[model samples]
Target: MRTLAYSLDVRFKPLFEVMGSLHAYICRKSHKKLDLSPSWAQQVQQRITPELSDLLDGIGIDGDWKLTYLLVHLCPGEDAADFVEWLKGMAAGDLYELMSPYSNLFPAHMGDFRDRTVRLFQQWNEQYMQHVDPEIIERLHVEAMKRKQALPASDPFAFVDETTNGLQFAPMNELKQIILMPQYHFQPINVVSYFGKVTLCHYAARIYLGDEDFLTPHEYRMIRSVAEKSRLKILKYLRQGPRSFIEIVRHMELSKGITHDHISKLRNAGLLTAHFEGETLTAYSLRTGALEQIHSKIMGYIEQGMA
Candidate 1:
């Protein structure tokens, strides 16, 4: 068996959240395909600042998904000037090599795209840096570090393992250094590519904006995962006992594709677990106490607001 050693670097940076939230906003405005809730769309739109809007206009929203990843990978600590300088220093070849995997999604003009993206980052830093709270960032970083250190011994992968079901990768003994970034925009978890020896994993932070307003990224995912009627029904069935995929489809009276999608959403949210009994038979069971834990958090959040 091949073992992959990993370490964590937890950071509370505004650039990551700003870029991510901006990309999410663009995705909503463009009606681009995203697996996010309509409620979140409304919240994000309300949170959008005038400066952010202008920045978006200057940068444009095309290929935002690609740009978001690039920004996270190239983030230069917390300094805005250094970040822009880093972007400016990159050679076209380096940019191309970094972004080539997403060539099909980006425009054919690589040089133009690189220049536009660098300008966008510069504009964002200049326009939005005032809104970033150093105190909040420090608090978030402390909380995130605590969360990372508190992961159960049985699961070394932590939130990554929980969200990805299990980490599946091509067998290699490469030293993987995982940087855990706390993001306010990207809910649950988002993974950037395997860049040399480093992998960037962006996880949602539990940001308490006010007594009444809190951002729980994982909770949002869980709520969204069970929102659909079909998905809710599937969860209900799974709560009874473990069921095979075929059995679930038959019981739900839904098409194979549809049932699979619902099951996948639940599984991805860590609400369900899959066990392969054999080469052919796979059974899925409700992740015990998962929903209850989420419920407690939600209720506590609500009660605190009431107080």
Candidate 2:
């Protein structure tokens, strides 16, 4: 099947990193077993001033995180301070016009949203995002830029899937543009959203630094993904062929949340392939090729140690 062509925009946005980290930090309850756990979020929260905590917590209420993520893209600055100031300078009508196309719900008061969101991001910058390692930021930016250069001659669907570990986000509706952005905080899961005519994909950036202790190794994660009894069963079932997420859930007889978690681990490790049917995950399959590479992967690691 052929994919419709869309204008591809790939770049690293500093605002995305700030928004991504905050979304992960604030929504830690639903993200247990993730690379950064709820415990890590709690530890970080303890260091935050009470006032800032109160302000940021509002973002987690009723999908306000969407507003934060959408709002930040309006700021093109590389620094958080500048991004905050850009938001502060936005006129109410201008802000409304900018956001209207994407959502119908506004904060109870637009005036309050204009003031509060800016202040929250400003303090968020001072208290946390500033401490983010500069090296990781640079690496994500470089990788996004490199992908942008290569995208012109590549199959758009295949490129999106490869960049996001089997997220085949096909073009649909009136969507005419796709932004492929690299993200760090939300590891192991790709975040996809829409606004007006643009589709934004914050693909997980597997940024590993320092030692090779398997902190975020592909081979180790791939091996660890199937270590659990439930995961093995799930894979065995998937070996039959592609099945929608619900079929696996019914067959496993586990809670929906538990089933999704197990599937996520397999997807993250590249042991499974997932495809979207118009923005909804409609199919998942065991990647036999990935299974085949497991042997070579371990051998490659062994070869690395030998060298």
Candidate 3:
């Protein structure tokens, strides 16, 4: 029922995908839990040189993932290559100034921050991004445009919430913009980034290139998600109320990685809702609407396809 004060800007900038590709590579190195297939992981491992591997660590990818927010706010246009070129002539002080309000970007560390970001992105652009297929970027743009057209002007926030699976945040009077970007690298999960008064929500876009041997229904994905014992247990725990991830970990007495994996799958299946303040996850709750429709969804799928 909550609505934004106004219709916010919903953009489909390719710059997000550019950064997402880099972030995805870093996740492969640090988290080792990417939803991407084993083949994708193996390909990344094969493509990475020792220098790129070391650079991923050296850039502190595992720390805060907000290093690219500066570009989000200040980039002159939507082109990724142009943004990088613009960043080349940017002074360290200017970079620090722009990034400081959103993060604790210090003047003392500005030079290294700028240099490392430039080097990291430059290497990534040459090694991988330049050869990216145009079709992938086109897919993201097409999805975003559809969502934008389908947006209900009265409750714009709902579109964001639905697109992001479960990312929710209270409306802010000071908020100026909300960006609904699409990313393919982090399939089946959402990435929400905060920059000053702007909120960037990056939802997953599945790459369906020539692999659509058959159609899979959302109901089927939801069924498969809860078919496992661990996921069902996680859902049961959330039945009571929303719980922070740490709280869920303690209550379930499971390792952090396993807990995260379960939550990610549940989120992807649209069975769970995640709330956030800034970039930090506040809590997670079950999407009772989806649960309530289990029978209807199953019957609908059967009637349409089987019956």
Candidate 4:
């Protein structure tokens, strides 16, 4: 058997968090209110400066919208100057090619989208750098460093398991490198992007800036996944060993759609792993280290006051 080779690079980037925070602010209303604790959301909202508020309001869209994809491609470095330089260097055609996926939301004229997005990003960076507390950045950096140091000695896949709260997995092939970026506002949320030979995994850090409890996106899903009686039964069944779809459905006594939804939630949460034997047969088993990972996270939060 040929072994696969890959590398892991982890670091803190202020601009990455800035982009995520901007996205969160612009789409604040679209988020399920219950996803974030009411007090925490309100506290973050209160901290938004009047100028920043107006900036977001002015650029905001009416329905569900997100500019993160466009912003991420334009991100050049960890500073405002780097972003400006990157934007300035890009040709109009290149910008159009990048923004094409989201073109429906933008003007038919590519230049208009490029110019407007660049300006919004510039303003967003300025307001973020001015108002965001320095302490939050420092805390996130510390957490990133801890994860970077702790990950190298463990299984590469384990890094994704823990960092994403079991939501994602390491690629089985053609994965050259993994870059980890930690974010505050985007906690409990993991965003993955592929560029060239590397995979960018942006995940929520275990940093609490003194307002409300923070849960990794995976943790939130796990908690919610087992909240119902049916889902709990699914877990109990899977805990015993691998089972086929028919076995699960029959045991749970639920419709295929409902059982599938529950299984998907568990799988996404990293609690269950699916093995496809063939086109018609799939087996589900509890991920071996899943519970331990959650236990470690909870303990880390309690003992270290961070995730």
Candidate 5:
């Protein structure tokens, strides 16, 4: 058993190294920029590294995936077939679809690692930019900046300063959210989507709102701590109209155990409202008025930040 565990760890060594470095990078950044706390570490791990780890797991079989990544470190090339075949021989065939070009457009189970890896290589090579084509990078940077400008000044979903700043990283959160979606789109370049327009729009809202660095330091931390990628869907549903506990559970298709805990937290925070429909319990109308006003204000903050 010990040997097996050791071998498995060895097989995943490359993955561990990359993720460990990236995790440290984010932690350092968060610490310097965002008052990194224990909670912040948890958030970064949950929102960032683990997502990448899952992707690595999906694409890897035994050591092949890890080997391919390591080879990239050693050889740095476009083609990954030899490494892919080597990994394939060791593990199940499930990850082939994820590795195939056809599925590259859709969201890979990897989440931000695609970007993170790109960033990592750039760090490794110390260049003007990394990963993406220069033209594409310029285009995306422009588009991201432009999108940052166009976000509404006052959205209908914001609650307080915490919620406002919470919206900052929500796009990354949405990427994580989409990763879990049964119909998630994986376009390697494009960040938009097709299936489930409502769900997509909910994601779109976060993109539109973009970054929010205007909040005070403490406020930003509070927001970041509360609003997570996993909660984005729940926030979306709340936006349309609040639902009863039962309704949210039904709509989200989450387990009762999970939904109950999340709902309790949201309600405690005043982001959601819960009540009774006859003998049964209910909630209604996503946050509006104050929440809406706050949401919009943060959106405006995002625009200004982009500018």
Candidate 6:
């Protein structure tokens, strides 16, 4: 799971870093109101990974294997109370339907979904059973049982009964708060596309505006320049939300010395910010929102140097 988590950081950081840069530029140019809530942003960022993995590992099973696993797990006679409880807790309303006779329901797609669903489940279960450590699975089962016995009915951990309503038990309080945050207060836009544009303009400057001696075409392709790689690596972890330097090192397999140096440079360059939750270092992605605007303006200066 940590490997998958690291993979996510490596894959998406560059893009999100771009998002950050674009955000900064837009705020400055449009002079549009930006929330730029640092603490809230950090909180949301922290939740990105563990939640994502839970959804993927649990309900995102392959068609055939997962289907059979669901049938046996959810059906009337084949009931595993503990498994059902685990499913209920892990299955976000977005991912699965937790009505009686548990099932994984995704939004409609064209074609025969029934057979495809079955096959997907089968493959998922085979892989899951193969990949997930037995001890971990057993531990989850054990813990679930313990919680079931000890906790009260209203306690979030108790999944003894399932609810048909789309709302599932939120694993964390912060998540519940976020879900309940007023969408009516916020503007409606395609978030993915919005973030995408922010990323493009952010990186465009890094790739296109730098001095030729300092940043070559090959470095652009490989994202190999110290600043460039730092930029890429930082963004990847950030796409999953902000991470501390320690988390970044663990995920990127970067030496502490190099990681510290890169983070400091980025901080100086105004691409990253560190927030301490008590003594623990929590870094927030600042390149988005207002910081992106500064990046664009700075890049204009860099472009002038190139010229």
Backbone clashes in each candidate structure, one number apiece?
Answer: 0, 0, 0, 3, 22, 31
Of candidate 6, the 10-residue stretch with the lowest lDDT total is 1-10
Give the CA lDDT, 0 to 100, for residue 224 in model 2.
86
TM-score of 6: 0.24
- Per residue, candidate 2 scores C-alpha lDDT tens digits across 98-193 of 888877766777777878877887888888988888887888888898898988888876677678776765556767787888988887667777
Give the poorly placed runs of model 5, Cα more than 4 Å off.
1-222, 276-281, 296-307
List the candidates' TM-scores in order.
Answer: 0.61, 0.88, 0.82, 0.64, 0.25, 0.24
Error of 1 at 209 (Å): 0.8
Candidate 3 yields a Cα-based lDDT of 0.71
By summed lDDT, the worst window of 10 consecutive residues in model 2 runs over 58-67
Give candidate 4 misplaced runs (Cα > 4 Å): 1-5, 33-74, 93-110, 168-175, 211-227, 240-307
Candidate 6: tens digits of C-alpha lDDT, residues 177-253: 11011011011110111111011001111112224564333223222213466657676677776676778888878
Candidate 6 Cα misplacement greater than 4 A, ranges: 1-226, 278-280, 298-307
Q: Is candidate 2 or candidate 5 better by lDDT?
A: 2
Q: Residues 1-307, candidate 4, lDDT per residue (tens digit)?
A: 2222667777776777776676666666745522345454456557656765665677654222243444564465776557767876777787657655433354455566556656666766665555677887888888888888887576766665567554333343445666778877755445565443455666667556554555655566666666788877888888888788899999998899989878866765667765421112257777758767677777777887743
Q: Per-residue alpha-carbon lDDT of model 3 for 1-307, expressed as tens digits?
A: 6666534655677777778877776666534344566577567656767787687865544334465654654688676667768788889878767666666645346667666777777777777777778888898889888777887553665676667666677666555667777788776666777665777777776555545533344445678788888888889999999999998999889999999988877888778988867667789998877776676777776788875
Cα lDDT of model 5 by residue, 1-307, tens digit: 0111000000111222233233333334333332223354454345444544453334422233332333333332332333333333332233344344212333333434344344343332222112313443333335434434433342322321122222111222113221111000111001112121111111111111224556643333334424765466787877776466677788888898888766544443335443322113335444444355456657878899899
Ranking by lDDT: 2, 3, 4, 1, 5, 6
**Superposed Cα deviation of residue 64, candidate 1 (Å):** 7.7
For candidate 1, what is the lDDT?
0.59
Badly placed stretches (over 4 Å) of model 1 are 1-12, 29-64, 94-107, 132-136, 151-154, 158-177, 188-198, 212-229, 236-251, 255-285, 294-307
Assess candidate 1 and give its TM-score to the true structure: 0.61
Give the lDDT of residue 236 in candidate 5. Answer: 80
By descending TM-score, how would the candidates be arranged? 2, 3, 4, 1, 5, 6
**Please, what is the whole-model Cα lDDT of each candidate in the order they appear?**
0.59, 0.78, 0.71, 0.64, 0.35, 0.33
Q: How close to the true structure is residue 306 of candidate 1, measured as C-alpha lDDT?
A: 95
Model 2 residue 251 distance off true place after TM-score fit, in angstroms: 2.8
The positional error of residue 218 in candidate 6, measured at the CA in angstroms, is 27
